[model samples]
Target: MTENPLKAKDEQPFVIDPIADTGAAKWSYFSLTFSLFYFFHIIAKYEQYTNTQLISVFVIYICFIALFFQAIRSTGKAVLKPIIAIVILSAVGAAINPGTNALFGYAAFFSGYYFLRKYAVLLLILNLAAQISSALILDLLSPYYLGPSLACSFSLFVYGIFSQKEYIHSCLQQKKNQQIEQLAAIAERERIARDMHDLLGHSLSSLALKSELAEKLANKQHFEAAKKEISEVASLARQTLSEVRLAVTGLKLQGLSGSLQKLTNELKNMKFDTQCYIDALNLPPMVESTLIILSKEWITNILRHSNGNSVSIAITTDANNVTLSIGDNGKTAKIKPGNGIEGMRSRVAELSGSLDINDDDGVKLTVVIPLLATVRSNVKNKAIVSV
Candidate 1:
């Protein structure tokens, strides 16, 4: 079976590590810092070059120093440093020596292509235009000229193509995470709405009916019957309150047996016959809660959609997994599932279980969850080893 795409957000780590992100930014700064110091040291000791050579080195050193400062200055704006540094260094490299310029320009182009994800294409275009124009200027000024610069310029363009793909993938990952979070929030909201509707709608309708019947009985001089009806109405209201509280607190103290018995009594009072059976005992609390939730949702779906008069609920557990199946005799409705089924699926998927719904012959929903025996055993062994 395919993995559920709507799994709970908290069950898995979503965002990449903040430390890892900070580390990458820090490394970018550290690399440029080292580069600036190394190049500056060379210029400081060997300043006997021609005026143009000294000027070119000075420009390159200043640009790298600026990049180091910018990369560390603004924690949130690290994207600009690589882009600016790459452009400046590419220029200085080309101006100094055609051969060396070709190499350094390729490096700078790739750095920008990889780091400045959003504007990668634009940076590549700009780098290409500048390098080509610089090559033409060099050809006019010196014999050792245009061909090498053109080759370097072409190399930078070609390098950007490969790095651009990686940059785009990073951009896509960031967008996908945002979308997942939005979708998870929407799913959680729908679940809450369904829980509220189930808790209130049935109880309110019953309350209204009981109130009407009690009033009618009192008018017919059936005071004792009217008093009894009032008590039942109060009991129903208290139980509904408890259910609402349980749903809100999300406490698993109400095990599968308690939850099912509650459902059976509630439906019986509401004039629907329910039969529940279990072949499991002392199940994991999480597994028991999962079963209860599944039972509640299936029952709710039956009441709202199937119009079924009878429901059969069965639960069984083996050493490795537990299964719960609920079936109703009434034919399935053609009505689409709104919130109930969606919430059931979400809860079951959180436990790494599968919920199967069959609309044929009768409405049947089945859920299966893995037992945690192996995990418990592993923990026990680890404890023993530590001792």
Candidate 2:
């Protein structure tokens, strides 16, 4: 039994954390300045240089800084213009002062990381073209320096491209884990609630019926019969107390079939296009209950978060193994591994099973449990429901 993934009492709502990273307050500015800072020493040696020459260097550096900052801040289509402008302006500067080659390389690094991969490579090519053209025209393409420069710059470009993607994926994975933790906690709480209800519901119902009969018998002056009814009520109370203790200790009594059948009807009522494919292999009690809870939580997540129109679930097993897979065509790329997912994983691990979640076009989860040698069998029974 899983608790509802909703507010119970004063529990705080789960919130997706902000993903934007603020590593440096003035990253773009510092990067541009440091990359060109070494070249400024060269300007001091040009004896024929006038005020205009120094001013040209300062003005070019300032322009690249502004453009680089803008390109860094903007994303997608908004960045296209600034990046192009920066590349062209850097080319002109490189023609005047070969030192601007460093600026061009740094620009290439950022472009490769931020832009679409195909477009990023194109920008890198443009940067190379400008650098080679400037070097050739100035007769300054020395093998000693050119070899190292090209190797280092190209490496930065490639590294930036891959590392940024990896970083984003890592961030997304962390966020997913947080979500799963939150959901799993909710499910555990819900499980406790269900246990309490099941333990008390039947016992209380029986208690009420017997008490009413006892009252009627007493009013009719049937003292002996009323006493017997009273005694039965006492027995029920004692039994109920024992059952409550078992439930509180996490001894769940609900079976797999009962829960699945109820879930199928619930999904139908909620207008979900759901299909269930179950096998009839007389699953072990523990395995059956675990799977039932997993299925419920999985479906609940779909209905609450997947925004999916349809879902397909399949359960199958071999001579010594069971495989269960559930998939939905929905925007699940953003779904994080919340508490519910974590709880499911922990339970499956205890049963010597594995669970994997794939996020491609949608969400698909596959769970495999290796049956014990004593429990493994070859019989097949399929229970499928589609609506």
lDDT (CA) per prediction? 0.60, 0.67
- Local accuracy of candidate 1 as per-residue lDDT tens digits, 1-387: 332221223433111111223433444444443343334434555655677876776676566556545433332235445455655575556556343343334334443433333344465566656666666665633444445545555665565455444433444554454566568557756786799898799899999999999999999999999999999999999999988876754333346777787777767876777888899987755567568767877787666766668888899988888899898878755637668788888888887889888877677878898885422221100000000
Model 2: lDDT equals 0.67
RMSD of each: 15.8, 20.3
TM-score of 2: 0.49
Error of 1 at 306 (Å): 38
The residue-level lDDT of candidate 2 at 139 comes to: 76
Winning model by lDDT: 2
Q: How high is the lDDT of residue 221 in model 1?
A: 90
On TM-score, the candidate that comes out on top is 2
How high is the lDDT of residue 173 in model 1?
Answer: 51
